[model samples]
Target: MKRSVLKFGGSSVSDFSKIKDLADYLKSRINKNEQLIVVVSAMGKTTDDLLTSVSHLTANPNDKDLAMLLNTGEQQTISFLSLALNDLDVRTKPLTGYQAGIETRGHHLKSKISSIESDFLENLFESNDLLIVAGFQGFNEVGELTTLGRGGSDTTAVALAAALNCTCEIYTDVTGVFSTDPRIYSNAKRWEMISFEEMMEMSALGAGVLETRSVELANNHNIPIYLGKTLSDEKGTWIVPNDQMLERKAVTGVALDKEMAHVTITYPLDSKTFLTDLFYKLEGAEINIDMISQIQNQEGLQLSFTVKESEEKDLNYLFDVLRESYTNLYVKIETTYCKLSVIGAGMRDMTGVASKIFKTLLTSDIPFYQVTTSEISVSYVVDENYGEKAARLLCEAFDL
Candidate 1:
């Protein structure tokens, strides 16, 4: 029998009532000849609450212990969901990431799935009509538990679908992907179909509906992902290959990432090792750097870049260490900035797109800093206060 993989986010299975409702929905979808695998995230706010509690014990908890603690949230979800399904007279089994054989690599709390052992999962499917697997947490090569970073559950679900050679359905609170966040702009249009390339651009640029890595994995394996609201009959969105699209818009969507900080450094040293040593330190810390600009003149070297505001503490610590060597390193961090981006596959064949963007912002007297571009996207950093207004203006200009 063929199998299908479905993933429900934290909000969909947040409580007992929701879990029961989801169980009924799953029962309705069960096919006599097909097996089902359900992957679920921790219930709403459980992971956050766990982190808050851990902070009470120690401000800086070890990554391994944090993973062990945070994983209980998903463990709670799987067991509760299994009980709910069995109570409905459905044959169900619950499994943790380790028990399900999801092997991962990388640092704890941000590990990536290296491989999945499907033999055990296939065996479990023989006597069970459904299997509930915890999402976001997996075991690494050293047999230590690790958690994937934010939106890891989405990655877990898509990875499972790829491994099993099955289609994936992701159920969340929203109906589907929108041209822009509906909360920010009321007229944001919902998309019925989006290409994997476009979706990957959107996610990486802070669309937030699906994690970037998950969409990348799905694209590599040619797995189409269905996204919709849980237990709702409303039409949803399908993420498919680019060739499946009938037409591409000049601009499809807009994304805003408010959690941004701009960092500038003026180093007085002209040593050749300055840039190399600085970047090597950042790489070892796993800090993602974006929008880098470097200039060398009579004033040693002036470097500017953007990074997530969430890494501010780490950036400060790293810079403090660097100061020990480069005593005259002048660093400035501005946290009042947000990154705004427009994405569309149609941009590849289009001209004047960037000009239009600059014109809109300039005419509105909204100042933007650090402009960057990809084949399908153009991003600008603007004051956080102007983020929503800039997004609305761009949406109207592009008719997104």
Candidate 2:
């Protein structure tokens, strides 16, 4: 018998009616002699609503209290789901991340699961019943409750599957993963499978279907993940391991980062010491850097890099950070930037992939402010004003 983990999103099990539908799916699946492990997120908008209430009440809420409150969303879902399963004559138990021995490192919010006990899970499976585990929230080593950030639920599911070495499938609202977000581009195609590296880049570049961290965990553990719409989930995208080497099209996907900002630092005009010093300064500040571009000229070499806009608010803090670290380099920050990416397996060996991208943008009359490329991806930085137009034109270029 095959063991699989099926995780339902908030929208999939958002309410009483939706919960009933899921319960039915579980009951029927249980009849297949297939060992089932279930993970679910909080009901629709419950986490968001709870956070809104918190923001209104306190500027700095207690982390422990906040986790406790945030966890109630999934708690309610788990208990309700257990009740519905009981109604269908299936014996089952629902365990929160912590109760299932999912120990983590986070104090309150954004805790990473360190290990899963699996003791209770071993006992619960004797009845050949389904196990429903709450997603997102877990406990630290100190036994304090903590929530994984935005994609907590997905992380929860992936973690459990990794710990148990079970087949994990993520259920969303679409049939499977599309070439691009269908809502954004009507021509976006769907891939039957994609490598872990490509998917991780996509998630980092703002692909909303899956979370970046979850993909990392799944990739590390060599686990397969399937993404499909639960509403009409006939088929979804299955993420599988691949070492296949084939020449891919000029571009497999186009990714955009709207909330992007760039920062440039100049050290003494002539020292190799300056570049090294600036990177160390930024690292000490804990500001994640992306697409670091460097240029060497008679005047000091110019070092440019990108960071998300969400981190832009703390830009000035880095100035103090740089001063404390290097005490010698001059720094400047720029926020009016956007990043566009073209990813494919064949980008490394392909002759004119970069040329095609440039021509596509040139024909659209959009000029790239900066361009960065890796073995499997090419990224271009442009003015934020044309970010949307650039993404649309790029998507339409390949009929994606």
Candidate 3:
């Protein structure tokens, strides 16, 4: 018997018609001797609408309560999809994260999967040809309903595939991974195959197709991932190990992250503990800081970093507390900047990749505020208004 996991994103299961279409497609794929596991996200805009409703009730709803309410979105999808499949004479069983024995740990709003009880799922396959499971949520050790963060449905799908020891197929709006976001660069080219390491870097730098955590999990287990448009016959991109890649390019793709907040702080040079105290508080809050730079100038010790704009509120409160100790502290938070990055596995043995990026942007008269690099990637922070132009220029320069 053949077993595999399939995941459909929100855009793919947005309505009753799409659900019906997906059910028909799945029915055709299931063989008499095969068992399939399907994972699904909430209907289009359902999770966003739920959050908006909670905002109307209170600015700060209890974390546990919020998780409890948000989980209903995916549960709705699993049930609806199950009903559709059942109508077509398919033996389907719908299971929520908790029901499927997915245990999670950590915060209520952004929990991580600890382990999955695959034996329970295998037993269900004995009596059913398909199991529809909810994505993005699982129960914590304390037995409270918890949600994974944004793009978490991808993580759930990959994790389940890892546990089941099978390949994963992810269906979304995009046909496959591209050289860059097609919406930003109309000439972006779709990739036939990508290395797991390259995919992880692109995801973390801001490619929305797959979650970074999901790519990391798949890479760790050597699981192959397929990404393609839903209900389409087009050949999609396959993510595999570096050794499995057919060709390695110095720059495989360009990624643009617009949801960034640039923070620049100037503290008195005499305050030796300023940097230590500030970072300590940020670490405690679990706020990720990136592209950090520190300089000692006549004015003071200047520090600059980038963080997700969604954490602006928490950052405001953190700086307020720091103000008490350092009365001369000066802080500026700018949300009008974006990060553009280029990533590839072949860059490990390549040089001038960074030079090409810098020259491309400079010659185009684009202004960048900060820069950072890894062995496989180089990122730059530029004005949000010029982000698209910068990405396009770099894509052209690298023939991406």
Counting clashing residue pairs in each candidate, in order, gives 0, 6, 0
Taking the tens digit of each residue's C-alpha lDDT, what string does model 1 give over 128-186? 99999999999999999999888999999999999989999999999999999999999
lDDT of 1: 0.92
Ranking by lDDT: 1, 3, 2
Error of 3 at 374 (Å): 0.2
lDDT by residue (259-362, candidate 3, tens digit) is 98999998876656888899899987778899999998777798899998988988998999999988899999999999999898888888888888888888
Q: Give lDDT per model, in order.
A: 0.92, 0.79, 0.91
Q: In candidate 1, where is summed lDDT lowest over 10 consecutive residues?
A: 26-35
Per lDDT, the best of the predicted structures is: 1
Tens digits of lDDT, candidate 2, 231-336: 5647677776656423346566777777788888776556666556655755654467788878777776677888877666456665676567556677777777
TM per candidate: 0.97, 0.86, 0.96
Q: What is the clash count of model 1?
A: 0
Alpha-carbon shift of residue 333 in model 2 (angstroms): 6.0
Q: Which pairs clash in model 2? A: 173-229, 174-229, 176-236, 179-189, 187-400, 188-400
